[model samples]
Structures are given as C-alpha cells and as structure tokens.
Target: MTTITTRTIEYPADALTMIGHLALPADTGRRPAVLIGPEGMGLSDVERRRAEALAELGYVTLAFDLHGGRYLSDPEEMLARCLPLLADPDRMRGIGNAALDVLRAEPRADLDRIAAIGYGTGGAIALELGRDGADLRAIGTVNAVTTGRPGDAARIRCPVWAGVGSEDPIMPPAQREAFTAEMQAAGVDWRLTVYGGALHAFHHPPVDHTVPSGVGYHPQHAQRAWRDIVDLLTECLPVTK
Candidate 1:
C-alpha cells in the first residue's frame, strides 16, 4: 500500500499558496520525486488518482494545486480564472518554482532525480519550469498551450515528451507543429505524439459531466496517457537500487 499525505505550503506574499498531496511507497526510502501540476479545472479527484498511481510505481509524487483552493466545472468560469494566469507566464513559472522548492526539501525525495508533469494549464507551468532551466530530469505534458516565445526553448536542459490530441481545439495541429519546430530549432531533446480524433482534457477520465460548455470525457485516452507518464518517469528517473 502507498502512504499519501496532503498539506498546504504557503508562499511569499506576492505568490499563491499551494495545496498539494504527497505520495510515497509504503516501504519508503529516498525515491525519485515528481512535481505534478493540475489541469485547467484544478486538482480534481482524477489528478489525485494520477499522483497515487505514480506512487505505486515507486516515486515520491507531489501533485501541486495551481488554483489555490478554488475550482469550477463551468467552462466560462474555468476560462476566466485560468486564461489570465496563463497570459502572465512569469506567474506560472513562480508557481512551478515554489513547488519544486518544496519537493526538493523532502528528505525522502531524491533531489537529483526530480521531474515534472502537467495537464492543460498545469502542462504550461511544467514547460515554463523546464524553459527557465529548473534542473528537471524530464518533463511530460498533455494538451498544453505554449506562450509562443522564441528564446524559451533554448533553456531546457532535460528530455521533454509532449502528448496532444489531434483535434484539440485549444492547441490546433498547426500550433503543435510550430511548437515542435521551435523546439527542434533550439536543439532541445523533445518528442511529441498526437492522438487522433481526441479533444482537450483527453487525459482526465473522471470529468464526464455536462459543463457550461459541451465538453465530455475520454476514459480510454486518459488511461493510456497515465501509462505513458509512468513509463516516462521510470525511464527518466530510474530507481538507483
């Protein structure tokens, strides 16, 4: 069984306070740690499950909440809150940095093998961390949006894997292609995989409800993405034992 604990870490006055959950293997030791950023809808039950799953794979995982403590299922409300934050890229980087600091301080975490993963807004946050040279071992993002800055790609020092849906309205095929081109031009080691006939939030399995908009859930894609994340972490942050 995995041992999980939830806690809140207060940031400086100008930064947001984060509510996060940490999970570790029941047999505990110094293990690789992953900082997980939540999706646009915030840290819902589905995201928590993902962290627990990573714990099962022998990682000490911390799923950080970007929204503080608020969440909304309505599309308009979700966009209203998430878009402004996304627009201010620096704020996202600050949040990621704060989470990274907290995770690095954990005695049971292998600081040298830290990695990050995120979805939607969270994905963008994870990407910004890597772009800012955060010393991450690896990064994986699902259906993330880029800020379209040119020089940001050159700062990444770790392997990056991005998963996107071909039909994702938020990140269209052209945008994804352009992002990939920029990454390649920067000489960053990166890989991108696009799933056909899928939409945004394809990795959120428990989010199936009639929101203010017409969005639904895709359980199959979500499961597959979760498995991919596990594999990526294992490959990038392998156990030393």
Candidate 2:
C-alpha cells in the first residue's frame, strides 16, 4: 500500500497569501505532478482529499487555494470574489503560475511532466495557465468551460479535456459550443464529456449551505468525472511505478 504525505503550504497569489494543500506519494523518487484548483468557494477538505488520492496513485499533487485560507459558504461572497478574478486572464494566470512554481519546487515533482486539473473557478485558472503557454502535459477542467481570449487557445501546448453537466445552466450548451469552437479553431487536442441529467457542480459534494439553483451533486457523475480526469493524466503524464 502506498503511504501518502500531506501538508499545508502558503504561497502568495493575487496579492494574498494563499494556503494550499500538498500531497506526496511514499516513494522518494521524482514523479509526475498535478496541480488542482479549487472551486470558487475556496479550498476545503474535498480538494485536500483529492490531492492525497492522486498522491496515492503515485503522482505529486497540490490543491491550490482561491480564498486565502477561507472557505466561503455565502454564494454572494463567492460570486463577488470570483467575478472579477475570472474576468481577468492575467490574474488567473498569476494564481495558477504561483501554484505551479510551488509544485515545481517540490523535490518529488518531475518538472517536465505536469498537468493541471481544476473545478469551477479553479478550472478557469487551469485554462488560463494553458492559454498563457504553460508547459502542461494535459489540462482537465470540470464545470468551467470558459472560452479564453481570442487566439489564446493556440498557446495551449497539451491535450485539453473538459467535463461538464449536460443540464448545467451555468455552463449551458451555448457556452460549451463557444469553448469547443475555440479549441477546434486552435487545433488543440481537446475533448469534452457531458454528463447527462446533471446540473452545475455535479462533481462537488452537497454542501450544508443552500446553493444556487441548478447547482447540486450527482454521486455517479462525480465518480465518473474523477475517473475521466485520471484517464486524462494517465494518457498524457503517465507515471511508471
């Protein structure tokens, strides 16, 4: 059985000191690394567990933070913070690059082989990193199929995979069409998975707080989406055990 190690890391991003979770596998040898971006609500135990799970699978993983050690349950607060940040690609890149730098600095991380997977706001950050020409092996995003700046998708130097709920009003068909169109125009190796009968944030677990309409969890789809993400990494950044 693989023994995983986890820790809390602090890094500067978006002018705030973000608290991130780092997970490392038992082996001391360098391994392919993955960066996980949390949803707009911020980093929570969910993301931390995901990082640990990836580490157990033999990859160094870092679950980067969005709200500087805070988790916002208030939808209004989350939107207020995420709206502007999402609008500016440079800010998103700054956040992603900062986390990437931290992941790269880890001795166990193979610098040349790295991937970015994110959800919600974090997904947007992953896409922004790709658009900024980050050397990622693959980019996997869920529930945030945002179209990047015109002509920027061409800079993505990796396979891009996106998963979204088919009925997600936030990421409706038109938005998905735009995103796919951009990817197609850029000639990127890209794919999209639409989970039927699911709503926005289907990958996320149910929260104690009341969520906005169209946002809910689907147990089966969540598991499927996770498997898809693992498949993406396995295909693009395989780790030899």
Candidate 3:
C-alpha cells in the first residue's frame, strides 16, 4: 500500500473562511496534483476518501470545503448555498482559486501538471475555472453539468471529461445538449459519459439523510465513474516519474 498523509487547511474565500483537506503520496518529490470539489452538501468523508485515493495513486490532492467546514445534510440548505454560487461564476471561481492556491503551495505538487475534478456544485466550480481559462491539464466533472455564459467555454484551455446519470433530472437531455454544444463550438476536447439507470449523485455512497427525487446512491456506477475520472487523468495529465 502506498503511504499517504493528510492535513486540514484553512483559507479565506467569498467572505468566509474555507477549509480543505490536503493529501500527499509517499513520494517526497514533485508530482502531478488534482483539486477535488464536493457537492452542494459540502465536503464529507466521501470527498476526503477520494483525495486519499488519488494520493495513493501518486498524485497530491485536495478536497475543498464549500461550506466553511460545515457539511449540509438538508437539500434545502445545500441548494440555498449552491444556487447563488452557481449563478455567480466569479464567486465559484473565488472558492476554487482559494483551494487551488493551497494545493499549488504544496512543495510536492507539480504546478504545471494540475487537474480539477468535482461533483455536483463542485463540478460547476471546475467548469467555471475552465471557463475562466485556468491553465489546467484536464477537467473532470460529475452531476453538475451547468454551462457557463455564452462564449465563456471558448476560454477553456484543456481537455474536459464529464459524466452524468442518464436518469438524472437535474441535468436532463436538454442541459446535456447545451453543454456539449458549447464544448464542441469551442473546439475543446470534451467527452461525456452517461450511465444508464442511474440517478443524480450516482457517484455518491448512501448517507443517513434522505436525498431529493432523482437522487440516490448507485455503487456500481459510482465505481465506474471513478474509474473514468482516473482514466482521464492517466490520459491527459499523467505525472512523469
């Protein structure tokens, strides 16, 4: 097993102090890094575990906190916090760039070989960063498939890979069409994978609280989606030893 280390970090963002969980691989040298964004529910054990997994695969990773270290279980609370952030690209970018600065500060992180992957609202953040023209090697998102303002996708400078549940109501067919159209129009190398019979947050594991309609845990699809993300990193953002 690869040796992994984790730390809790605090930084300011959007008028609040944001917290992040950083993880590093056993190697003491520089390596590729990934920034992880969580759903509207905020960062939880699931996101932390994902960061650790990436670290084990020899990448420095950070799971960013969206709610100032608070985990929201109520859908209403989550939407309340996320909706506005979604509508405001600058605010989402503020949160993302803050965690990005923290990740970039890590001595072991390869500044030039960076990627961002997120779920739900976190996914939206990833998209915004791309639209804002961050020099990312790759961008992978799940569930949160919102497109940016018209012409904004033209700013993306890297390959993008997105996944969504086929039955997800939040990102139904029309939304997917618009997203893909923007990607294609911008001539970005983008790919989308839709898992059949799955719902929103299909990549998530079961939780104690109830989720909204068209939202449930799909373990098999979850694993598949993770593999796809890993594959994306391997292809577009491989870290050379």
List TM-scores for all candidates, in order.
Answer: 0.91, 0.99, 0.98
Candidate 1: residue 114 lDDT (0-100): 93
TM-score between model 1 and native: 0.91
> What stretches of model 1 exceed 4 Å from their correct place?
1-14, 145-148, 206-214
Best by TM-score: 2
What tens-digit string does per-residue lDDT give for candidate 3 at 37-67? 9988999999999999999888999999999
Worst ten in a row by lDDT for model 1: 5-14
Q: How high is the CA lDDT of each candidate model?
A: 0.79, 0.96, 0.92
Model 1 score (lDDT): 0.79
Q: For model 3, what is the alpha-carbon lDDT of residue 175?
A: 95
Q: Find the 10 residues in a row with the least total lDDT in model 3.
A: 232-241
lDDT of 1 by residue, 121-160 (tens): 8899999998888999999999884744678889888888
Question: How do the residues 1-241 of candidate 2 rate in per-residue lDDT, one tens digit apiece?
Answer: 7588989999999999999999999989999999999989999899999999999899999999998899999999999999999999999999999999999999999999999999999999999999999999999999999998899999999999999999999999999999999999999999999999999999999889978889999999999999999999999999897
Q: For each predicted model, how many residue pairs clash, with residues at least 3 apart or on different chains?
A: 0, 0, 0
Evaluate model 2: give its lDDT. 0.96
In model 1, pairs of residues that clash are none
